[model samples]
Target: MGWLRGDCVGRGSFATVNLAVCSQFTTPTVVKSSDVFSSSSLKNEKQVLDRLGLCPEIIRCFGDDYTTENGEDFYNLFLEYASGGTLFDQLKNHGGRLPESDVRRYIRSIIRGLAYIHDKGFVHCDIKLQNILVLGNGDVKIADFGLAKRTEEKQSMCECRGTPLSMSPESVNDNEYEPPADVWALGCAVVEMVTGKPAWNVKEGSNIFSLMLRIGLGDELPEVPNELSEAGKDFLSKCFVKDPRKRWTAEMLLKHPFVADNTLSSKTSSPRCHFDFPDWVSAGTASVPCSPESVEWSEWKFDSVRWSNCTSPVDRLRQLVTDKKPNWSESDSWCLVSRHQRTV
Candidate 1:
């Protein structure tokens, strides 16, 4: 049976992702296509995904083909369709920022995928929320390997790769890319998944040079949202270390307390205890639910928070264990800091 193209679902710099129906296939699949003149990236992505083989945390490549329409040869790649769309879309669905439990689960899947990718000798240079697809089962798979390259491949010391927002400090400053570069991007992606904003208070078309400077030379790291637990912040710390050599790998991050701690165990009887909020911690005037939205946070004291004990992963997925930090400045400007808007 011939392929029947459906509505356009997404448009990218190199290709357009479309929902398609192939009479030979039972389940609907997505087709990412680019004209022959501009097909190198698409071809590269397909080859990389094929080399990766089968991975639960990675979108499956279902082969590729080329078609001539109106004299233009269009190359296409068939991929597993994720009905839940991208993690970025999920963030929007939650009105910016997913729940800690959801973030933990998704991050675990991402770490698994990254680990497998690294083990296979490839580096997914592009690892952002938009590049992560979510299945109908709520499981996430890393996608968009257009920028991926073999770990052993050497490039010019000054050639930068990957999305600017998620580029590692080393990649920005020295053009050094390794498995750790993906870890750095993974950290930035986690921040966006939790806070509904890019790691830095910047966008695609803004002063990229200035952003790179802050990422490369400045001492200031992206401001961690007050909503995250000590473990969550520390997890980010491992990813944001200026030295790529010291950055935590996906395998190591999968074992982090932020992802493994079962404080809010679904199987445990004390589900409310997941918040880990002490009775003394409350809204200045009332007892409100301890959520990212409820905290009247103003200035952030990044240096003062104490970390929680990292625990091993249990059968059940865990939620963040938030503790009261005395350093957060109390102010009415809390509303302004709750969510940072972005253009991308």
Candidate 2:
């Protein structure tokens, strides 16, 4: 890939940094990776995604090719650019927290994505917020196949590789772990999304011993927010459990009451605003993008004045929530307006 520094969105240990590949490629397109990893693992991820059959929720794999600059070959997996940015960005920006409802949303997406992957015989060995990207329209995509491996749907012991912050205790201990390890990381990501801090946020970043000290051992779990719905609390508790066998399944979490149907399941078809959200949703910055045809999106209204002015989260929140009406044109750019729940 002969891309420039401007194409760079991220850098990593093994691959060429996340750089925009196409020149004047304005709309964001994730480059297929040119990185290093075990052959079976990469092959597993490729076959798994291929079995997924072009899912919109998952990033699209453009093509696999060689990196001329690095002189090493790789499977190029390109995907959509989530302009709103990462869940990690949102969590950190707000001092390590977000609304519980929003956390539920992202977690739900994680479950769905994981289910799809697992259904196709693969385990996302690395599941973290940084690997979760968001589109402007509120949907999410799971990235980073470098560590993914094909596996049977059943649970079992598996080795692990990823940041310690999201590592499951079983995986951290180097025991036999399986898909449940990913669920554990998903739980960690969810907690971080709502609290804005890792389960064990301490002073020294390099003090591995110190970080481990914060992570309670077998049968010792962190204190979760009791305010979470019984379903939410129970769901995370199962996910964070020390025993992988005792952990919750991604499918089970998908069906949990908290995530049952929050996507479009509100009693009234009103937009999901942040006015009276609980501590977590009130705190997090993740959002579900509104489709223009969204009847729920059109009817929602808030203080545009506040959105247009202010220095606090209130103002920033209003900006993302604020609906922008597309300007009407006399000569419509390719007009064929068959009404289908118009937002305007």
Candidate 1's residue-wise lDDT over 1-344, tens digit each? 37977888887544688998887766769999988877766788898998999999999988899888788889988999999998877887887678888888888889999999999999998788878999998899999887788996987532345665687777766666689989988888787778776676642223334555667775666656567766676667777777776567777777777776657343222112222222212112222122222333112211101111223211000111223333334311111111221101
Q: What is the C-alpha lDDT of each candidate?
A: 0.67, 0.53
1-344: candidate 2 lDDT, tens digit per residue: 44433366654323333545676455677664544442333444566567676655576554444443557555455556777667766665555567778887788777898888777667777677767887888788887565566564432222224454566676545433368878887887766566554554333212333333344354455545545555566566667667677666777667666677665332322123232122221223223212212232222211001011324322322223313432222110111112221110
lDDT of 2 at 335: 16
Instruction: State which candidate has the highest lDDT.
Output: 1
User: What TM-score would each prediction reach against the true structure?
Assistant: 0.75, 0.63
For model 1, the superposed segments whose C-alpha errors exceed 4 Å read: 203-205, 264-344
Cα RMSD to the true fold for all candidates: 13.6, 17.7
Q: Candidate 2's error at 122, in angstroms?
A: 1.4
What does the lDDT read for residue 309 in candidate 1?
27
